[model samples]
Target: MFQLDPELESFRNDARKVAERAFAAKAAYWDEEEIYPMENLKLMAELGYLGITIPEEYGGSGAPVVQGTIMLEEIARVCFNTALIAQGAINGPSRAITVLGSEEQKKRWLPGCVRGENIFGIGISEPGAGSAMTDMITSATPDGKYVVLNGQKCFCTGGHVATHIMVFARWGKTQGPRGIGSIVVEKGTPGFEIGHPGPKMGGRGVAEVELFFDHCRVPVENLIMAGDPDSTRSFKRLMSSFGPERVGNAAMCLGVAQGAYELARSYSLERKQFGKPICEFQGIQWKIADMATQIHAARLMIYRAATNLVDGFPDPLEAAYAKLYANEMVQRVTNEALQIHGHYGFTREFPLERMVRDSRGFSLGGGTTEILRNTIAAMVYGRAFDQRAGS
Candidate 1:
């Protein structure tokens, strides 16, 4: 069995209490009305939950990455949408800055983020670029002391409400991943336009939008990589952040699955069919057993990946495996849990329907399951193998 240290276990307990009290109460209203849970977010920040992994020098708790993952898992168990916001609030632009930003940049952003005074977003996927990020057409042209940005980025989580966004763009004439770099774009920069929130099947409160940068000029200091934008070294530095991102995403999936399992387990015991409770039936009991087992397995994988991050940058292959497995595992667990609830599960009266919708998106976000498989295959085979070809 996997275990957390006493300190971490205590922290997890505290997080679970706060999540149930603050996040769970507002989950349904936010999902029904598509309202952001600002109050819950503020409460989390005040309790120091929002900055679990940030260094104390930057007005944060300086906790390990595992603590942050534990907090996310607990929060997500109650409200996945709120958890989505927390994920971006803690691990999105703030993390990008920590990994790639200058000392001055960190000083300016990290403090406010920890205080919940600033909201940051990440802009990576474009209409033309989704899985193949290197195919992005967004370009940053050098013009004296500033760089002019011209392109559009879609599916920008938190874009509509973000105070600032870290945008990935092509820095020079070079093509593919080598030419890509990240830059910070403040909310009101000239010629930068953020569109209205796009529709989503789940994660309603967080606004995913399109960003238009037509001759958007930003100071040269905004450049994340100061040296050799076109070099492989710079690209690798930015990609290094993906390990944590994947781990965080996996934790969210694990939480949703766990919450659904608990609901199903309780309903099975109390909901009697014929004479005794349905849980006494062999079929219902078997489903509950499978759900509990799978959730335990997924949690172990998520924690292993999160702990690996504490020592150094997590291994990309390990992160991918955890995320890929947990993401898919949530879908299976949620579905079985819903099945246990019968028709009641499909109604808004219970959270199972919402859990199902929310869990479905996990396999598509962070990194698509298909894309993650290719990553894992490359690592295992020592070369990219074409899946379409007959072995």
Candidate 2:
């Protein structure tokens, strides 16, 4: 049931070749300079990776969610930064537009995104509103034919390069989730600009900068779900569309974990200890065993989430669980991998250190593990969580 189709397998092989080439050329530079891989990104565009999940009508491959996850996992195994960029730029916005955008919006936005002409970014997490969407201070006021947006969006990936961003803000409504609405804002808008890009310990090649929108005007037609401001239905719709993005994140995390496990397993066999290969040692073998077990479980969870998503009945809590498990799983696996390498992993000479740093970011990105736990508990217990009410 989880097997790849022949056509998808062919695509995966092609993507693997592209990922291998990227690994050979940009892997070292990405880890060393901590910079974005624009050259590799250009190559990805040429290779059609940027549009793997988009429809053929929109200049994309129209690959299913499972295939998309496979591509992300394969690329991430070689270069985590590239995987992050592909997943963030291509998967998130492409899926969002495919699921939520109007026909006109789809025609206007998806072709460019799939063609690599329009870089895309997601603007949901805010400075104070992370994990709690209700706390976002960003507001939108209705104008004659547009909405005036004013707010700060922090930790926006593709911040410096995105040609368009899906901005979420409270549109002067009193309710929490009901007031939230999303608009597509193009770059170079009068009041739209990015703050200084923040340095990150991992996934360094992808820019995470703060977006400031001061009286930015967006056409009402750009709204993904224009509706009454008193209903949570719109936000729910957005979340439904966002399911694939979360699944992509889980896939990337699984790739990182699998990569680290492979590295550590190889090193254990090659590196010598007091006697035979280190793999002969019980401790090293045990570590490798645990790493493999955890990664296997992570992969299964991610695939299950992806399958559920494709069926149009995704459980957000399951996606969150997959993301949470995979994120924490990668961190552990990478750390063990680094430990297997001893001092060599500590230096910049090997990719292990970079993998460790990259894996750490998984825990914090997407939906954080801590917050996802709450979401899981809520789903299992069937109760709304109210921090204020102490539920």
Candidate 3:
């Protein structure tokens, strides 16, 4: 229903051009090496694309969340890893710092993130608990002047290279989301061990790893959103950040699908079959039409989700709606694009194969399709469904 303003479109164009030049050539190298793309991250910083949502007073662009999605979509179209570098600042823990951190903390952290001089990892999902976040068992017990943390965290994306990690653990033995609060664990903190990066089929360059907090003691001041003694109210407040994260995830998927479709569109025109360009084939034409229509729909859904925010972040329902569609849509779109290229698409030379691999992870991360369905249902019905209790 709505369209991008000229300024936003200009911003999108600038990012797309930069990505085409700087990230396109290196996307394969980064995916093959599985090494962090710090150089590209620096370029993003120079462009002021990092921390697109953080306020300018904190040395950020202070742009709306929509701009962040646009930036991510453009970069992911060329290189998924480079787009992730931008996401490291605008999503997850860095974002929480902007929203929930004290003035002193914001002054200390947000600028570095905006500058791309800092990468913050999120330590939330655990081996034993992911979708059922309330079942998390990590503990953070109060000591005299510090809180001792004891737990294991898995799926800590960027943990291997992050300067700091924001970990959520139980403040006491209280279970089921209560007493769940988070604290910042600086790199090299005693008793905090970072494991080797876990290999993935996609999102290759960014490191996702395991984290251990064995009696990891940190100053009580490191605790954020921990004001309530019982910590009863912080869980919902903290998790609201995932709304924007999901929107960002959807944007990346949208970009990848568009990239694949464009490649297919070009190939169909030049690729001949039976002495005629494949573009003349009705079958190929229909596939191209479907991909274009789907991409257009996803773009609109993502922009809508990005623009209409509840309290400066995406509404969970809207984010879920956009993410679910984009996640499923990308898989279909990429496959169709690959099919259009025929046998050549299955090879690495065309980038279609890589696009298919990279596109798969978006649905897995951010939130699973199953989990997102639950989220959408909760929002629509205005009820929190406890699956543990059978109806």
lDDT of 1 by residue, 1-391 (tens): 6778899999888889988987898788888898878887788788887787888999988887788889899999999988888898767777777766789989988999998888888888999789878788899898999989999999988788888888888877776667778888898999899999978888888768999999999998888863245476766677777788888899999999999999999999899889999999999988888888887887888888887753345778888999999988999989999999999998999999989988988888778999999999999989966544365
Alpha-carbon RMSD to native, per candidate: 2.0, 1.8, 1.4
lDDT of 3 by residue, 155-268 (tens): 888889998999888876587878888899999989999999988998899979999999999888787766233756888788787888899899999999999999999999
Residue by residue across 200-273, what tens digits does model 2's lDDT show? Answer: 78888887989999999998988876534778877777767666777888898888888778888988889997
**lDDT (0 to 1) per candidate:** 0.85, 0.81, 0.88
lDDT of 1 at 83: 89
Q: Would you estimate the TM-scores of all the predictions? A: 0.96, 0.95, 0.97
lDDT of 2 at 307: 74
In order of TM-score, best first, we have 3, 1, 2
The candidate that achieves the highest lDDT relative to the unseen native structure: 3
